[model samples]
Target: MMKYSTSPTPSTSSYPRSTSPLPAPANYQPTTASAAVKRYKYLRRLFKFNQMDFEFAAWQMVYLFVAPQKVFRNFNYRKHTKSQFARDDPAFLVLLSVWLFLSSMFFALCIGLSSGQIALFVLFVVFVDFIGAGILVSTIFWYVSNKYLSVDGAGGDVEWGYAFDVHINAFFPPLSLLHCFQILLFHNLLSHSGFLACFVSNTFWLASIVYYLYITFLGYSNLPMIKNARAFLLPLPALFVLYVGTLLANWNLSHMLMDFYHYRVL
Candidate 1:
């Protein structure tokens, strides 16, 4: 037998040692500022405003009013998918808010509101009445759907985000029409028209509002989770009450502002 060397021979490895640096930690936490910047970028992307998007959104707004079922059927809830609804687009909402603000400002000017009153009107009517109310109503619907009814066969809950999309799309047409009527009236466009024209315009506005409510009813009725008529009807009363209450609150706020302005002037 060959005598084995007592000393170990130098090892000859064919593989080179890994010179590559180890990968950074997979769960590395971003700095707070970096995270904030990421969110800002995300929001910018989500709310991107372009002329084509605006035109499409305007068309969808009309389509939503004319053929809501088709619109709802086509609505994409996934953030990754592109959406036509203004509610789904931040830029659209921003545009809408700006339009509302300008409209309210014009109304205030037409009414001869003081600067303070105009400010209040912009704050309350544009911001609170429209945007805030949309959010609040959507939340209410979302809560009612989740709390009282099983939305899907799999017990999937109604998401507030989707509720908001539905609510805003269904709600905005009538609301915008109402604003348009106000604008026309304030600008004396209706004054030049005969009584019949005025009557027709007012009637149209009222019909549009009724249609808005009807569309809302149809919206909830179409949900897969709403199994029976009773389930469908349950949410209606609350929604109607909320709708009426919003109108009353807006009226009251306007009157109160006018009264306060007069008092101050006196």
Candidate 2:
């Protein structure tokens, strides 16, 4: 019987054990889990209405319209006190969602859409147009700012949630313009197909886009650790050129949008 002694494994066991932990992957990040936790907490707070600061949110909305730059002061304060650039409260998001729902519903009704169609339109606009598109845009800007616009030794980075907040803040004016104001003016003024209608509608769009860009600039510029925030405003001239091009081409963007919505839901 050839006895292979299990204890005779000195060759295998004699190697020195490395006390240093194995290196993590080059791209492995713990911040991903922290971000996920923050996102989860934000979503969880959505259902807890009693815990939301709606009145402050309403004030913030008003400031977003009248004095958007002032809104960032609160974010700055939040950074100082809470040590984060993003809002923990979901009141703003909830209020914006409610406003979006109401505005889209009324706009659909004004366009003579059927009840069922109106519901679908609302869903498409709120979910697809607002939330979905907002997330995409936020992610793009977040990545751009973090990857490209970051300073070398700033010791801080842009927060994805903060980027999202910036997007929604910028999105508010456009939403009001296109969904609420344009609908109000549609039958009376914008329904006509002419240069005058084009000018009015196009100007609304231009102003709304300008508002979006300006607010976006303010949001990024307000971040203490961010640099070259003026890059956000670079698109304005291009937007102006496009606005002119659309006008010269006699494109009734509002009409085109209405048709698109009709095609989608009707």
Candidate 3:
């Protein structure tokens, strides 16, 4: 009654009510769980395990070294259309990495290093041989492929990662053989039969080298960019050159390491 001429009271229903939820603020952040889930999914897909069968993949990997031609023929590069930037089988790459690591450890163990020293040696091999050398060789192959091979008219392009994939796949057989020879040599399994040991080790080494050359040749020959045999053979000389250069570069370091092992552990 104080203000007798009262207007309608400004009640809670005076303004309109929103049916939709409010928009997230500009500074809004996702929950940690949500982010982790997304990362896990991404990693799984990237590694190609989402679509791969473990047993089949393992068999195929073994076949890659044993029956390379059959494996190569079965390989369909076009299937990896999603990997326009980087085309490689993540499973194969991972297997190769693991093999490298295990081979390094085996060598270190054969040298009779202490546990701590073996661990360090394995780390060195993983970092220097696997990571560093892999990157260097892959880069070289990529450059050679793009520069020399003309892919302009071809249906497919030579991606850097794909080139690396080819390089690694082609060389894997030789690497495995070489590792086997090293293991045998180090373990003295055939030490009593010196001639047999020498013959077997040399056979493995020679076969590895020959297989590497043959595989590289076959790999390049099948490329879309290389049309003629002459063009196909061009990469071979470059590969040999790179191989020799890499060996020369690492010779001193390898010798030093061997000497250290012999003096300290053997």
- The order of the candidates by TM-score, greatest first, is 2, 3, 1
Q: For model 2, where is the 10-residue window of minimal lDDT?
A: 5-14
Model 3, runs deviating above 4 Å? 1-52, 77-89, 189-198, 227-266
Give me the overall lDDT of model 2: 0.83
Per-residue lDDT over 73-149 for candidate 2, one digit per residue giving the tens place of the 0 to 100 score: 66765565455779889998999999999999899999999999998998899889998999999999999999988
- Cα error, residue 238 of model 2, in Å, equals 1.2
Which tens-of-lDDT digit does each residue in 109-216 have in candidate 1? 766778887787677776577778888988887787677765456434555555766676666676666556544653354333344434544544555566666666
Candidates' C-alpha lDDT: 0.53, 0.83, 0.54
Better of 1 and 3 by TM-score: 3
Using lDDT as the measure, the top candidate is 2
Q: Write the per-residue lDDT of candidate 3 for residues 19-60, one digit (tens) a residue.
A: 123344455553333334534554566566544334444554
User: Which one is best on TM-score?
Assistant: 2
Q: Score residue 38 of candidate 3 by CA lDDT.
A: 39
**Between prediction 2 and prediction 3, which has the larger TM-score?**
2
